[model samples]
Every structure is written in structure tokens, then in C-alpha cells.
Target chain A: MTLRKRIIACLDVTDGRVVKGTRFVDLVDAGDPVELAARYADEGADEITILDIGATRDARPALLDLIGRAATALDVPLSVGGGVRSIADAAAFLDAGADKVAVNSAALRDPTLVELLADRLGSQSVVVAIDAARSAPRVWRVRAVAATEETGREAVAWAREAVERGAGELLVTSIDRDGTRSGYDLELTAAIAASVRVPVVASGGAGSVDHVAEVLEAGAAAALLASTLHFDILRIGSLKRALADRGLSVRLPRPAPSAQQVAAWLG
Target chain B: MIAVVDFGSGNTRSVLRALAAVGAEACLVTSPAGIRAAERLVLPGVGAAPSAVEELMARGLWEPVRRWGADGRPLLGLCLGAQLLLDGSDEGDTPGLGLIAGRCRAFPSVADGGPRQVPHIGWNEVRTDSGAFDAYFVHGYWLDADPAAVTGWTDVDGFRFPSLVRSGSMTGTQFHPEKSGPTGRALLSAFAAGALDARVEAATWS
Candidate 1:
């Protein structure tokens, strides 16, 4: 049994509520983060990533209370990101019940923070989130601060550096494809997965289960879905079934009893 | 009570939460006294092996833990906790409790023709005596030991490694059952319910 391709549900949280946006702009409120996360876990999400989009802008910490609530409700691993500037900040999230702490802007500012986080809270618990946009035909550059700032560093190179610096996993989001519902930037995801030894989670532009299949086939170890799952355009169970039918390994939820089976049990 | 040894590593809170979700009476055991009084011992860890071992020693837990397993008590290890049960690990060149006869080695990069990632971080299926079930994994190194000692195995990138192992009263899992959804919750619930005796019997028969 090879490591199954993961389907992670991302909650773009602002304040205490889960929200969604198109290319990191024009936000729309979805629901409470805890409630949505619990639902996703029930629906068979392999993992949950709660990215506090408002943390850095407000200079506030990641929603510790919210993470705690979600952690209680979720049996799967929960990864929290945003506004994690120091080891203490990352520690705070882990203490609040996060299995992993993802750093983006902080890591770009000081690459050593990656080493620190890995040193302080095991490499398995440190995830480096890279937001990238297409810079050239086949090249992508890293974007920081909610995709508002360009770092000029190439996406693939940064991914390799992050792994070298001690990030156990890389959550690579394509700014150009984010929330576009077209599909993932397969080329971009493949490049980073190829360059690094850590598992790469391909984020952005998931319109259909087929799109997820495409990216996973292209070498992404996991797929992060936000808009589609939040808006009810796609159901996680159906998507997992589709992937399983396509011969992709997925952690399918226990099958619900059919009416006949239920009747027999009641009888 | 199920005492979860807290050696200042990562993910202890989540482990506690998972235990609670399964309705297991669990608590964080931070000292040697806590270990001595516990009905069951759960060694939970996540981080470098050296620091984990250092913290355990600093807290005066190293000897008690080894003794607890030696006396054939119900002791379970999770992730780094499981790695530390072996003789030693290449991770940080740290020594383990040597409860099991093995050493931890890093996962190979070249498994088949493709490049495999380290820290096998995700959910994967594990084959055990009970059945095949999915569990969450996050580790760079796996136990290199005799096949007879392994209770369960998982295949990744064309390489098969021991995901779960049992030696007398000591059982360890490389994957985090607390983070592995329903199947994981079931495993924990069983462990809390005196299933270790059944495991011992099964091992003896096999």
C-alpha cells in the first residue's frame, strides 16, 4: 500500500469564520471554521489546513481557540498557518492542538525560521506554504503576504531551499490558478515535487475530481481544495470515490448501510 | 488512567484529544511518579530523537519507561515514541530505550526508478492481523528489525517497512492512530480495552 494521495480541505479563515476568495481577493464568508472543518473530516478529507488569512494583516496570532475547537472535532491531522513569525508562535499553534504549523511570509523573510521551527517542533510538524504565480512560460515565482508581495525567488528553487532548511512538507499554492476553478498548474506542481524530497501538496484551481486526478498523476502527493468544497460544488465523498475508481489510492470512509441492511438490522 | 508521557515534544495535545474522543481516561504524565502510578503507559513523541531522549532523561523518565515495558505492562509508543523504543536511531545519532531489538534508519530515496519523499507524511493503509486499515503517518525513519517482531506493515514507494511492532507487553506504531480517523479511534479503543492479552496470544500462535 503506497502512500495514498491526500485530499486536504483548506479553510481560509478571517477572524473566526471560514471564507473563500478568488485569487486571494474578494472574500466571501462560508461558515464557522470549526463547523466546516468537522463536516470536511466527516466527508473524508484526508487532512485539514486552517490558514488564518487575516492574522498577518491584523498582526494577531492564528486563531488558537478556533484551532483547539477544530482539533477536538477532527480525528485527522490539522495543520495551521499564517502569522507564525517565531518559534514561540509556532509552538503556540502546536500547543493549541495543531499537528503541523505552516509558515509562509515568515519563512520568506527569514529562511532560518524554517530550521528553527523544524528544530523546535520536529520537521514533521513544520510545513512551508509557498504561494506562487507564473513568472515565465514554465517558471513560477514565490508570492508572500496573501499573494500581495512578490519575493522574486523562483518557486522550485524556494521549495528545494525550504526542504533543505528543514520543512517536512511543502504546501505549494498557485496564485494564478487559486480559486479559478480551471484546474491546478500541473507543470508548477510537478516542478516543485520533482525538485524536493518532501511531500508536495498542490493547492489552487481544483474544479473537478478529474483535475485532482490530473495533478496527483503529475506527481503531487496531495491536493488542497478550498472553493469547491466550501461552496458545495463538490462533495468530498464523491470525489474520493471517483479517485478510487480511477485506481488512485484514497482513504474512503466506511460505507453507509443500504436500506435493506438497515431494515434487516432493525428487524 | 492512561498516562501519555509528555517529553516536551510535539502533538501531545492532539493525542490527548484523540484519547478523549475515544472516551479513554487519559492524562499527561510529565514525571517519573506519574509513570509509576499509571494503569497504562502511552509514550507519545514528535521531534528529533536526541531532544526527546534528552527530555525523557531530564524528567527522570528514561529508566521508569524501560522498567515499565520490561515488567510486561501495557505500554504503547506513538511515532517518535515508537522510534525511541528501539536500540537507537540515525536521527540525531540518539540512543533509544532498546526495548525492541532494532535500529531506526531513514527511508531510502530511490525505491524503484522514482524518487520517494522522506517523512512519509500522509494517510496510508496498514496491514495487521485484524485487517487492512488506513492510518496517518509522519516520519522520516522506519524500524529496521526482524519480521517476526513486526505486527503490521505498510508499503510506500515500493518499499515495505514495519508500521506497527509488538514485543511482549510493548507495542508501537509508526503511524499516529490518534490522527487516523475512525479506524485509528477503534484501534485506540481496543488497546484501552485489554486487547494486549489477545495480541500476546496471537503473537505466540503465529
Candidate 2:
């Protein structure tokens, strides 16, 4: 069985605007989320993610309009999340042409909502988003939404339970490793890889292409990124070729990104 | 029309737009039948293990997605979507699709207190040991498994993680491209165009 690997493009949005940066401290305007997403699709992004970072401070109702434009603009899959409060909100994203809606704070508020959503949409539609922190050694806890200001919860344990309850996948982000460029927390990643039965994509702390290889080697089925690609320092075609050469079983191109396209991208 | 599962996770709109912008015929699908009939499948997600998987289940696409990945019928998982391909996650003690042989864990050195913030966000160089171009990253939990499974990698604070991976019929990433400028655009294009041939062809036929 030959599987084609996918490259996912994520856009962290705030107040209907696309933002780019390293630490989430100093961010620059990338462009309109919809326009940029469409451009990347034209360039060859396998999928797209629209993250509403602003959803934390204020519910971004404008996302509906943005979603409509973005959905109408691309032919690939698109998923949206951030401040998604209820099943109705999830439905709203789909109505706007989103393929999925990620509920974070809401899910934290009601863990059983995963089961509720699973019953309504199925097991694959409900995604539990945990933005957690390390309170102590080997102890990761849900950082917000009632589980707040405490460190008694074990993140790994919750992951297993979520699957049992009815979650199809997991997206784990290390608030510490995020935007650090120091490299991913491999030790933590390994631990998660060892425990979970589902595919795990490593996130946070990447500076070079080798990091991608490192996470994959660590057993992550996928690598989620942000900074490097924004810098125009790495190209996916080259990375694919490099992976293919390493005998890691990558999605090889009959004719990868033309030298021109790659060069243009680098520029 | 192809199905793009939506339940409240991932950068689904951008993925859809990328497809349409590139002139690929696609749709954001939510029903079991719609997903089952999709010529090709694109699974995108974000957030915690429990929640991400929870949403996938809520959408009633667990069976369909699992079947697609298992069948090797041109399936792609991006960012958290890619992570879901793993067996489990430490973020929320959640299990994933199990398409790949690995688990997701929390970041280390968080207790150490210097720069071990959760949700590793931002753009950094992605120089891979494979001698390929570098990429970017943004998240907290990382992947840990066998060294042989890596496709691409990047460095940050002296640590490294796989930016890309491929295990049989599945592939995934831990980055956001809809935000990455031109380099991201090129990569996304390659994914929709050059990087994948089987899926594109199958999608066309379907």
C-alpha cells in the first residue's frame, strides 16, 4: 500500500487578520487568511488550517465570512478552530465551508462533549484541543477552562481517555516549545508516541529541516510547523526529496516543484 | 466531490481554498456518505489529543477516515491532523487514528523553567539531516519514536523534531503553511501538485 504524504498549511488568525511571528510576541501581517490560503493551495498545500488565536480574547464572528471566502477560494480540505463554543458553532464553520471545527475551551469545559459530538457527527468530527503547560516533571495538565491554575492533571492520561470516549485524533502543542526555535521536546513527544494508539504529529520548537526528520524518526506520523516556512528558508519539494533519499518512505514527486517555482519561493 | 471533514478543528478553510485556488475540484464534506464517496481524502486538525479525536468522532468519520488511510487511498493529515495519525497523545492522554506507529508527548524541560513554554509557536529554520531545505513549526507536544521514520526536521533551542513524516499510506506535518509566505506556498503547491501523484490522479478519476 502506497500512501501519499500531505503538507498542511496553518494560519493563526486574530480579529480576522493573519499574523506571523516566532514567539507570538512580535508578529507580522502575512496577509488576508483567505487570499494566502488560496495562494498556498495554488502553490500545492495539501490541506489548510485556520486557527483563531483571537478566539481567546473575543469570539471572532467575522470568521464566518472569512470561512466562506476561504472555502470558496480553495478546493482542498480546510479546518477552523478557536473559541468554538458549541455544536452549533461547529456547524457554523462547516456551513462556512470548513471541513472541521476544533473546540478547545469549550471541550475543556465539558469533556463528555466529545461523546456528545461523536453521537451526533461521529467519532472523527470532534477534536479536543488541549493547550497545556508543564507544572512539574512528567506532569502535563490542561492549562485553562476550569482546570485552571493547577497542575494535578496528567495530559497523557487524558489523551487515552479521550480516545476511549470518542476522539479520532489528537493535536498536542507544547506552550513551552512553541516559537522557541530551540527544537521540539523529543522526550515528551516520545512519551506520547509510546502511549497513544493513534497517529501523533509533533509540534513546537523547530529551527531546521533536520528537526522534521527528527520528529518523524521519533515516531510522529506528521510534523506541524510555522516559523521556518514563513522565513522562505525551506521548500517542501526539497524536503520531500531529502526524505525520499533517506529511505523513510516519503511522497516522492514525478516532477517535484520545478527549479523555477522552488527558486521563486525561496525569493 | 471530495470530502473535507469538519468538526471544529484544523485549518480547514485554507486547505479548501488552496485546493480551489489551484483549481482542484473539492468540497468540505461532513456526512459519512459524502466522505465515503470522496475520490480523495484530506484530514486536517489542531488542538489537544482528546479533543481532536473527539471532534473526528463527533463528525462520524472515524470509520471512513480509518478506512481511507488503511486502504492507502490518497489520504493526507496536516498539522494536528497529521498528529492524529499517531497512536496517542500525551497532551490529553488521548489516542489517535493509529495509522502510524508512534505516540505524542508533552515537551520536556518545562519544569526546568527556562524557555520550555507550551505551544511552541513561530517560524524557525528547518534544516533537515536529509540535506533538504528547512521548514517551520508552532506547537507544544512533540513526536518521539524511531529515528528511521523521519522525513524532514528542524532545530529550535538546540532541540529537533520531524517537520514531515511518511509511514506507508499516511503522511503528516506539525507546521502552519497558510501563514508561511512563499516557501510555504511552494510547499503547499507541491503537496497539492508535485509532492503527490497517486492521490491527484485518483482524485481526478474519482
TM-score of chain B of each: 0.92, 0.83
| Candidate 2 per-residue lDDT over residues B70-119, each given as its tens digit | 88766667778877777888877887788877887776673544233234
Top model number, lDDT: 1
| Residue B192 local lDDT, model 1 | 73
Model 2 Cα lDDT, one tens digit per residue, A85-167: 77777877776777656666666667787777656655545566555567678777765442234434567877777666766
| DockQ of each two-chain model | 0.33, 0.06
Q: In model 2, which regions exceed 4 Å deviation? A: A2-5, A21-26, A56-59, A145-151, A252-267, B1-206
| DockQ-based CAPRI category assigned to the predicted complex of candidate 2 | incorrect
For model 2 the local lDDT of residue A176 reads: 71
Per-residue error for B37 in candidate 1, Å, reads 1.8
The DockQ of predicted model 1 stands at 0.33
Model 1 lDDT per residue over B141-190, tens place? 89886677787888886788988888776778899988988767766776
Candidate 2 positional error at A237, Å: 2.6
Per-residue lDDT tens digits for candidate 1, residues A141-249, read 8989999998889999899999999999999999999999999999999998888877899999999989999999999989999999999989999999999999998
